[model samples]
Target: MPDTSSRIARPRLIEIIAALATGGLLTLMVLSNSMMAAHTTPLFSSLTAHGVGSVVAGIALWGVWLLRRGQAEPIAKRHIPLWAYLGGISGALTVIITSSTANSALALTGTLALGLAGQVVLALIFDVFGAMGIERRLPRKNDLIALAAIIAGTILIIFARGAS
Candidate 1:
C-alpha cells in the first residue's frame, strides 16, 4: 500500500486557510463596492456578482474541510506562492482603479464574470487532474457535468442581471 502520510503536508493546510481568507475578503470587497456603486447612476444592483462567487468559494472551502476532517484527516492542501495571491489582489485593485476613472460597471461585471470563470476552470481542472494539495475528490463523471452546468448557469444569471 502507498504511504498516505507522505502525500499530505503542512503547506497544504496553509494554502487552504489562505484561499479561504482570500475568497472571503474578495466577497466583502465586492459587496462594499456594490454599495459604493449604488451612489452612481444605474450602475449598482442589489446583487453583486461577487456575492455569487462567495457562495461558490465557500462551498469549495467546506468540501476541502470535510475532506481533511473525514476521508483524509492529515491531508495538507497545496501551498501557493505569495505572488499568486497578490495577482488576484492586483486584479481587484485594477478593477477599483478602472471603476474610479471611467464608465466601469461594464468592465467590473465582465471582470467579475471572468474571475468566476477562472475559479470554475481551476476547480474543474483540479478535479479532473488533481493538483495543489487538492485531490480528485469527485469520482463520478456526473459530478463534473453538474459543476460545469452550475458555472454555465451562473454566467447566464450574471448576464441576465446586467441586461436589466
Candidate 2:
C-alpha cells in the first residue's frame, strides 16, 4: 500500500473558496438562530429554521426534477439504517446549544471558535474510527498539530472574551 499519511490531498482553489463561503453561511445561520432563540426559544428557532429549509429543499428538488424529467436514470434505492436519521436530532441539539451559548458570555465569536474546535476533535475521532462509513485513516502529525493550534486558539478566544 502507498504511504498515504504524507499524501494528504490538497484542496483546490474552488474548494477552499467554497469552504470559506460555507463558514460564512454557518456564522450567519448561527447568528440568525440565536436571534430567533432570543426572541422566542431554542426549540421554536430550530423548528422555524428546519421548516424553512425543508420547503426550500423541496422546491429545489422539484425544479431539478422538472429540468431533468426523463434525462436521468431512476436511482436505485438503498437501505438506510434508522440511526442515520439521528442527524436531525443532532442538528436540533446543535441549534439549541449554540443558541444558548451565543446568547451567553461566549457571544458569537467565542461560540464559533469553540464550535470549530469541537468539530476538529470529532472529525479526528470519526476519521480514525471510520464512523458513519467514513474512510478509516490515522491522523497525520500535521493533523494533530492543526488540531492543537485550533484548540489553543479557541481557548484563547474564550478566555480573552471572558477577561474583557
* Model 2 CA deviation exceeding 4 Å by range: 1-8, 74-78, 97-118
Write the residue-wise lDDT of candidate 2 on 84-116 in tens digits.
878888877887788779789878677878788
lDDT of 2: 0.79
Worst 10 residues of 2 by lDDT: 2-11
**Candidate 1 structure quality by residue, lDDT tens digits, 38-143:** 7763234323444666799999999988777746355675676676655556555655555554455555458658778766777767766666554545435665
lDDT of 1 at 145: 75
Model 2 / residue 79 / CA error / Å = 3.7
Q: How many times do residue backbones clash in model 1?
A: 1
Error of 2 at 120 (Å): 3.2
Evaluated at residue 50, the lDDT of candidate 2 is 97
